[model samples]
Target chain A: MNVYIIGIGLIGGSMSLDIQVTYPEAIIHGIDVSDAHLEEALQRQLIHQKATLQNVENADIVIVTIPVHASIKIIDEVLHTVKDDALVIDAGSTKEQICKSIAAHPKRRNFLAAHPIAGTEFSGPSAAIQRLFEGKTNIICEVEKTAFSLQEKALELFKNLGMRIRYMDPKSHDKHIAYVSHLSHISSFMLGKTVIEKEKNERDIFDLAGSGFASTVRLAKSSPAMWTPIFEQNKTNVIETLDEYISNLQEFKNLMLQDNFEGIYKEMENTNYIKKILKGLE
Target chain B: MNVYIIGIGLIGGSMSLDIQVTYPEAIIHGIDVSDAHLEEALQRQLIHQKATLQNVENADIVIVTIPVHASIKIIDEVLHTVKDDALVIDAGSTKEQICKSIAAHPKRRNFLAAHPIAGTEFSGPSAAIQRLFEGKTNIICEVEKTAFSLQEKALELFKNLGMRIRYMDPKSHDKHIAYVSHLSHISSFMLGKTVIEKEKNERDIFDLAGSGFASTVRLAKSSPAMWTPIFEQNKTNVIETLDEYISNLQEFKNLMLQDNFEGIYKEMENTNYIKKILKGLE
Candidate 1:
């Protein structure tokens, strides 16, 4: 099988690397606008060769893994050009926009909207590594729109990547991701900004930053290029989640100001449910 | 030297384990309000024996590693019971309250107020392990209250544990830590709360949670018993820092609502400075 991956950054590049490692016979092709990244990906052997948008026409599978807005545009362009038998999948965070963009495509049956719940703060070809998708969840939205054979092909690919697949509607996918993923990026970015603004002396932040700060601030290192579009595309849900997050923080602040140790203790105890939930995932 | 640890939880147990590995001749005595933790500490061999408050009086050095409020009470209690020349040190998050609690004690010269910037989300004596303090910063506040000779002894201990030491006023220590450390815990706990509230299905949280959420919410797994008092002790500073964090999120939300893509992009782009800061620390 020939796989064409657009935007060979962390997610896309890692997927390509994983596919190549697991199925050595599968030919991998990559497409990226950045000349330097494409060069890096080629030099690192992340792909068999560099391909253009038109090259996706020959692919058995075309994966759209660009920034959210760009992913929508590329998916439309690929649908307009690819073979009817080709399976086109998007690994974008927000699904509603892309699902709507291709809702009326003549080759709509060839497309599948997927979000493999995996990523890192790093980006670009150098950030690519195998096994990034291992033991992770892959949420596929609007699966009924795709042909049965294509859906089977996509499922096999995800299974080969060691991912568990689940189904949901595009709108629900956006809402759940807004809560679980997008809001996390915003919280991390703003926390990073607040601390950076507070300690003008970078040395002080470095000296005092423990693992907590590093973990909480990790997502802030993600690509602004990728996340800004996600925040914009899912603006309404993102804003609502952000408001809920801010209100939670404010309420806790009020409890602290009143020196309500009991209130603070109870609040944290309630939130400590995350431990059980996290362990349950494994 | 004989070292008596007041609380044998994540901090104290980990310290005792590391100290034993690094300094074989040093004997570690354990004390805790919880009998379970003491029993676990002894079972883990994190300490030579479980002892009582009386054990603190005979020690050459006593390290009070307990909650913020408990540290104050223990400091005052130790100040009255320890030898005139014994070094009494604390490893609490907030220094101002603990420092002031022992300000006028006759043994103030022997008390060292320290905050080591290291910990994991897990707590209890079972959570302790070797090398928790390696390559971490240990901040000593209000060193003026400690005798020069006693300060030398405390600094020697931290150095032997492979920690770089920083000296600052207690007020400044609280203010700086409010942003660097305390705010992180609040952000993480609140993020955990927001997600858990949104996704009523705990299984969805575990399934959809990626390394980003895991890293951002890692501190949410911290013990409420350990953190509740910290929020109460640093109530004023924590509330102020939390207000700043909330406003930062609010501003980002406003930008998103306004569809101010450039503003949102630049905000995250600028916050990416944390990467450089973190790299410098490494």
Candidate 2:
């Protein structure tokens, strides 16, 4: 099988490596707008070759792994260009916009909207690894809209990469992802900005940062180009989640100001339910 | 040398283990308000034996690793009881409160206020590990208030644990830590609350939590008992830093709402300075 992956950054680059490692017989071609990324991907051997969309016409699978805005554009472009039976899947963070973008395409049935819930703060081809998707969940939205053969092909590919699959509506997927994923990036980025602004000496931050701060601010290092569109595409849900996050912080602040130790402890105790949830994730 | 640790929870318990391994001849005694914690400490071999505050009076080194408020109370109870030459240190997150509480003690010069800027989300005696302080910064506040000989003893102890020591004024330590440590905890806890509230099904959170979300929200799993007083003692500083964090989040939210892609991208791009800072840390 031949796989063509668009946007050779972290997610796309990783998928390229994972696929190549899992199935050495599969030819992997990568596409990216950044010449630097393509060069790095080649240096890292993340892809067999650099290929354009037109060159991907013979591919058995075409994965759209671009940023949200570019993902929609590529999905539309592929619908007009790829073979009718080729399995086209998108590995975007949010699903609604991408699904809506290609809703009217004639070859929409060949397209599957999937979000592999896995990544690190690092970006570019150098960050890609062979097992980035192992033990992670891959949520596929509007699966019934995809042709049965294409859906099966996508499922087999994800399963081969050691990922669990789930089905959900595009709208619900967008809402849930905004809370779990997008909000985390926003919070981390803003926290990094806040500390950097107040602690003017960057050296002090480096010397003083313990694992606690490093872990909490880890996602602040994510790619801006990839995330900006995700925040924009899922605006309402992201804003609602951000508002609740701010309100929760404010409530804790008020409790601290009043020296309400019992109140603060109870609030944290309540949120400690996250422990059980996190364990469940493992 | 004999070491007496007043509270055998995460910080204290971990210190006991590290000290035992670092100084094999030292006999460590543990005391805590939580009898259950003391029991666990003994069963885990975190301490050689359980003892009371009276055990501290004759010890070569006495360490108070309790909450800020509780540390103050313990200091008052044992200030006169301890040997004049015994090097006493408190490992509380907030230094100002604990330092002030012991300012007028007749044995004030024996008390050293130190905050080892290291910890995990997990807590209790079971969390103790042998090398928690290795390669970590141990900040000592108001060291001038400590007698020169006692200061040397305390510094030697931390040095033996492979910790690099730095000195700062208690007030400045509290303020700096508010940005580096306290604010990160609030950001993480509130993030956990927001996601849990937004996604009613904990299963969805467990299934969909990517590494980005998991890393960013990891600190939310910290012990409420340990953190509640840290926030309480550093209330003003925490409130100030939290307000800055909220405003930063609001700015990002506005950028998304207005579809200011360039602005959002620039903000996140600028915050990516964290990568350079983190690189320097390693």
Candidate 3:
């Protein structure tokens, strides 16, 4: 079996590492826009060979792991070129756009839209590590659109990577991810911008940042190249979530202005349900 | 030596654990409004004895660790009653109000306003742990207001806990903390509230939340009992920081509405400097 992975950065590189371990007989081909990423991926042995669009014709499996916008642009082209029986999967954060782009493709049955809900704040091939998807959730959207055999093959691969699979439609997947993933990156990025703009002295941020600040702002370090496209592809949902978030903050601020300590306390106490939800993730 | 810890919760209880290990001969007295907390502290062997306001008279060192509003209300009383040489320190998130409350007290020189930048999201006595202060920053505001000898004694204790000490004025401490510490809490809390409100299915949140979302919203689980007062006490700074954060979000939302992907990308790129700053923390 030959596997072709596009956008050989954090997600792609990590998937390549795990696939190599699980399917030792499989030949891995890497394709990325950056010469440096392809070089790094090859040096790290993430792929057996560096290939391009032409390689998809021979691939038994093709994985698109680029920014969401980029994935939307290139997935159709890959779908038009892959072997008839090949399983084509994408691991982009947003699903609706990419799934919609290939909806009418003749090879739609061969494509699977998945988001392996895993990543650190770091990006690029160097940030890749083994077992990145282990014990994590993998959300597969529009599963009905994919052929049953291909779905089973993808499930086997995900199971081998130690992932639990969940299924949802493309629209629901976009809405849920907007709140759970994209909004978090936006919050952290804005937080970093707000703090950096206000606190002129970097020494003060260094000395004063506690573990809470570190954890809260950790995603601010995420790659703009990756996230901007996600936000762009899922603009409606992202904006909706952002509006809700901004309104919540404004409400809290109004309570603060009014010296409504009890109100503020009640708001936070109500949200403490997140504690129980997060424990399940752990 | 006798050490009196008021409000025996997370910070106070954890401090007791370390102080006992460092000063075995010192008698530890715990005071708190919550009887259950005192009982748990004693059961955990976090304190040598549970005491009352009367214990302040015998205290050679008094540490005020409670809600910021409560700390403000009680520090003057603690200052008036402690031994002339007893070192009094308050580990509240905000510093200006607490420091000012006791500024004119006769025993003011014995009091040190410090904010140890450490803690997990969990709270109460059970949340306390050994070495909670280990290798973390301890910001001692208005150090000049503390007598030289008492400062030396306080330094020794923080050093024994493996904390690096830095100095600042109380006002500056509150302002900086509002951004780095307090603002992070608000962001997390609001993020949690927004997600909870939107994603009605608790199971969806449990299944979909990745480590990035988990870390970003971890502080949302922090005790409202503790944070409400901190926000109230540092109202001006908190409000200021929230305005900036809200403004940043609004600006990003505007860019998203305009499909200004480049603008949003640039914003996140600029704030990527946070990655370098966070490296120093690790």
Candidate 4:
């Protein structure tokens, strides 16, 4: 079996690692814009060979894992280039527009839009690791659009890699992900921005930062090239989440101003239920 | 040596655990308002015996680990009752008010204000664990205000717990901690509140919440009983930090509205420097 992995970064590079282990007969071809990353993936054994988009015609499966801003055109190009019998998948963080863009294509039945919710603060080939998707949830949008033969191949890969599948519509996926995933990134980035701004005048301000600050600001280290497109694609839902978040923070500040510790206590206690929800998810 | 641990919750109980192992000959007396906590501390072997405020006179060290709202009066009461040579320390999150409250007292020389930057979301006696302070920074405010002999006893305990000391003025400690510590809690709590509020309308919203969301919202699980007083005591600084955080979010929203992806990318890229600051902290 031959697999073409476009954009050999964290997600794609990691997929190559697991694919190699899961299917020993598979020859993985790495395609990336960066020569350094492609060579790095080759040296790290994340892929068997370095290939361009032209080599995708020989692939049994083509996995596109580029930034969301470039995903639609690239995925369209890949679908237009690959064999009709082959399965094509794009693992962009946002699915709504990409799914809509390919909805009327002749090879629509050969495509799958799956987003695996697994990553780290780092990026690129060096950030990839084996078993990154093990026990992670892969949200597959419009699975019914994919041909039965193509769907079976993707399912087999997910099964071998120990990933569970959750079917979601493109619209609902973007909306819900905006609240959970996208909003957190904005909050964290803004937090890091605020603290860094304050630390400028108060040189020793960071010395007082504890594990809490580290945890909340951890996502601020995410790749701008990756997250910028995500926020841009899901702009509406992200703005809605940001509005609610900003208002909630304003309410908290007002409570402090009013000397209403009781109200402040209730606000936090209500949100404490998140602990149980997180525990249940775990 | 006699150690009086007032308020047998996360902070006090954990200190009891370390003190027991560090000073095997010393007896740990748990002094808490909750009878259940006293009994639980006894059952968990976190304390050697249960005692009250009146017994503080026989103490070599008095640790006031209650809420910051109640700390001033309790520390004053403990200081009033304890022997002149005994070191009376209050580990309040905010230090300025607590230090000023006892500045003119006859036993002011016996009082020490320290804030240990170590805790978990869990509270009460059952949440206590040994070596919690190991390698953690203990911000000591007004270290020079305490009598030399009394400060020596507290220093010995810090050394035995494997904690380091950073001597900061009370005002600076409170101001800096407001940004690093208190502001993060508000951000996390507001994020949790925002998502939970959205989940009410969009059920299964949290199903898409990844490790990023969880990491960003983890501090929401912090006890409101512990945090409300912190926000109340450090009201000005907390509000200033909140205003800055909210404005950053607003600015990001405006950037999104204008479709300025470049501006959004720059915002996040600038804050990416937090990674290095946090790394240096570690």
Candidate lDDT values, in order: 0.87, 0.86, 0.90, 0.90
Q: After superposition, how far is residue A107 of candidate 1 from its true place, in Å?
A: 0.2
Model 3: number of backbone collisions = 0
Which candidate number would show the highest DockQ if scored against the true structure? 3
Worst 10 residues of 1 chain A by lDDT: A200-209
- The DockQ assigned to candidate 2 is 0.77
Local lDDT at A131 for model 4: 94
Worst 10 residues of 4 chain A by lDDT: A273-282
Model 4 agreement with the true structure over A1-282: per-residue lDDT tens digits: 999999999999999998998899999999999999999999999889999988898999999999998989888888888898899988888999999999998889989999998888889999999898888789999999999999999999988878888999999999899988999999999999998998887766687888888989999999999999999999999999999999999998898889998999999999998987787444
Q: Judged by TM-score, which candidate is best? A: 4
Which portion of correct inter-chain contacts appears in model 4? 0.82
Regions of candidate 3 where Cα sits further than 4 Å from its true position: none
lDDT of 1 by residue, B148-228 (tens): 999888888898788989888999888889898899999999999988887875455456677788888888888898899
Please write out the lDDT profile of model 3 over residues B93-176, one tens digit for every residue.
Answer: 888888888878888899999999989988888989999999999999889889999999999999999999988888888888
lDDT, residue A171, candidate 3: 91
The TM-score of predicted model 1 comes to 0.97
lDDT of 2 by residue, A1-282 (tens): 888988887788888877887788999888888878888888888888898888778888998888888888778887778887899988988889888888888999989999999887878888887788888999999999999988888898999889999899999888888888888888999999999999875356456678989888888898998888888889888889888988898888788778888999988888888887788454
Per-residue lDDT tens digits of candidate 2, residues B1-282?
889999887789888888987799999998999899999999998888989987788788988888787888998777778888888888888999888888898899988889888778888788887778888999998889999999999998999878888888889888888998899988998899888877765465557777778788889899888888888888889889999998898888787778888999999999998887777343
